[model samples]
Target: MKIAIIGTGNVGSALAQRFVQSGHQVSFGVRDASSPKSQKASTIAGTTLLSIEEASKLAEVIIIATPPEAVLSLVAQLGDVKNKIIIDTTNSIRTRPEPYATAYHALKEITKSNKIVKCFNSTGFENMNNPIYSDFGGIDMFCAGDNKEAKALAQNLAKQIGFSECWDFGGDDKVELLEKFALSWINLAIMQGHGRNLAFKVIKRA
Candidate 1:
């Protein structure tokens, strides 16, 4: 998969490496190609740095790892996202996108694409970098969106990166719920000091 990650922060960097390792072509999309974040991301093997518009145009899958509010500004730069798969990995915890509750909503509205699912935002970047935890194995991931094919792609991407499972939290209405789920992770991992090493999983028995 050709993927362009918009944002070179912790979450973006971690996913970029994981995707690249999983045999996906990864690139960092940014306003400034020479910025410290972009330059640093370019150092990662199999990752390139391109302008936001340029990167979006070239990739089949576009992952927005940028801050929630920034999506408003990048909408114009996202170009014709019409039918591409856009996995939004941002939370509105610190900053909502105003008219939209989260980046998922914002992207869905502005980009005019239903192939947008919210995933990869539920845990610390450390966990995403390497989900394995001794005997426990890889941690679970979660996503929510209306498009069936989009959700499947996101789930497949999750599994490709060592996530034990990618639980479908349900459709569009469940997006905010998933974001809140992400906040729960943030609260416990940071606020409660339960540690970032902790993760969530579902156990079922027949």
Candidate 2:
């Protein structure tokens, strides 16, 4: 799988490393493609550091890890990713003291595209890279996309990264609900000081 990560930040870099270790060809794009972090990440992991155009062109799956403000710009530049699957990992956080990620506006932008999926935004990077949900084994991440096929593709990618459980939270419009869930998790973390040791489990009773 040829995967391109649009941002070289904590989330982007961490995801890139995990994907690479999973035997995928990973490429990372950044504002400063030659910066130390970008170069080091690419070199250490043996992945490619490319321009947005180059990366987008070569990738079958695009994982967007850019900030909320940059997502629109990044998508605009990506042109013609019509049939491709885009996994968005951004949070709409304000500058307030106890910030929460907003998704109403972001969901609006995503509803227009058939190629987008809202996922990997709720959990911290620690869980993103190495998630161990149950003693039985790790579970794949959760994802929601308007397009069923796109969601399936994202699920397959998750499995490649050692994730066996993938939760489908319905249409892409439900993406806002997932982002709101992240805020609840944050508030709990603040109150209990429970770093990233916790995870959500959905059980169905027969």
Candidate 3:
């Protein structure tokens, strides 16, 4: 899989590294070609720095890792990605501690005809790199996309990166719910000392 990660933040870097390590071609999509993080990993053969358009053109799976506010503008710039599978890792929280637009609204507005699977937004960056499932526990990673094929592709990718319980929440309408889950997790991490070690586990007795 040729993967394009649009942002160079913790989530973006972590996902890029994981994908590269998993033997996939990685393009670190960034505004500046000479960014330190982009240059630091230049020695890796298949990892390259590319413009958003180049990344979009070359990669089958494009992960939008930009901050929430930038998502719409970025997608607009990327243009017609109809039928392409997009993994949205954006969260709707701004720097001022105020919530940005909801993921549902963002995705709906930005994605015209693209197949977007919303995942990697609900967990912390630390957990994203290496999510551990203890013997008695597992995390529920929610994904919702209108296209079934796209959702399945995203689910397979998620599982490849150590995510276990990939819950299909049905359609792109529920993207806001996933963002809310992340927001709630942020608050809990601050208050409950939960940090990245804790994740929601759904227990069903048979």
Candidate 4:
């Protein structure tokens, strides 16, 4: 999979490295290729750095790990991505894309693409770096989107990077709920005194 990560922050960097290590082509879409963040991310061997438009053009999937409000700008810079899959990894808990509830909502409205899946936003970046806990084996991931194939691709990508399972949180209507789920993680981990090491996992009794 040719993947374009639109941000070089903690979440973006982690996913880029993981996907590249998993044998996928990972490219970074940035405002300036020479920026410190971009340069630092480029050091992660096999990762390509290009303008937002360029990276989006060549990648099969584009992950938006940027601020929620950033979609307003990206909607124009992204060119035509109607045919590509977009995975939004932002939460509206902190700052939302005004008018739209979450980044996923913004992207869905702007791109009008059904291939938009909301995943990778419900946990801390540390967990994203490595979902596998030495004691627990591998933690679970979750996604929600109307497009079955798009959600399947996201689940496959999550599994490829060590997550035990990528549970389907539900379809598009459930996207905001997933964002709330992310806020719950944020509340428990950051606001409630628990450390970043904390993660969520479903337990089933049969």
Q: Considering every candidate listed, which one attains the maximal lDDT?
A: 1
Q: Give, for candidate 2, the lowest lDDT window spanning 10 residues.
A: 95-104
* C-alpha lDDT of candidate 3 relative to the true structure: 0.73
Evaluate residue 151 in candidate 1 and report its C-alpha lDDT on the 0 to 100 scale.
94
lDDT of 4 by residue, 1-206 (tens): 89999998889999998998899999899987888888899898889889999999999999999999998887788888889999999988768899998888889888888789999999999999999898888898999989898899999999999999999999989998998998898899989989899888888999
Sequence-dependent TM-score of model 4: 0.97
Q: What is the C-alpha RMSD of each candidate to the true structure, in Å?
A: 0.8, 3.7, 2.9, 1.0
Q: Which candidate wins on TM-score?
A: 1
C-alpha-based local distance difference test score of model 4? 0.91
Which wins on TM-score, candidate 1 or candidate 2?
1
**Candidate 2: global Cα-lDDT?**
0.71
> Which one wins by TM-score: 1 or 3?
1
Q: Each model's TM-score?
A: 0.98, 0.84, 0.85, 0.97
| RMSD in angstroms between candidate 2 and the native structure over all alpha carbons | 3.7
For candidate 2, lDDT tens digit of each residue in 1-206? 88888888778887887888888888886667777777667664668888887888888878888767676556556656765667887766542112223332453354355667777776678777786666847654777768787788877777677666778887856776776776666666655688766666566799
- Where is model 3 more than 4 Å wrong at Cα? 40-45, 95-100, 133-138
> Which rank order by TM-score, best down to worst?
1, 4, 3, 2
- Candidate 3: tens digits of C-alpha lDDT, residues 1-206: 88888887788888877777778889877777787756664545567888888888888878888776676567665656785678888776653112335543565555665577888888788777777666754456778778787789878777777777788877866776777788888878866776767676566799
The reply for model 1, stretches above 4 Å from the true place, is none
Candidate 1: give the clashing pairs. Answer: none
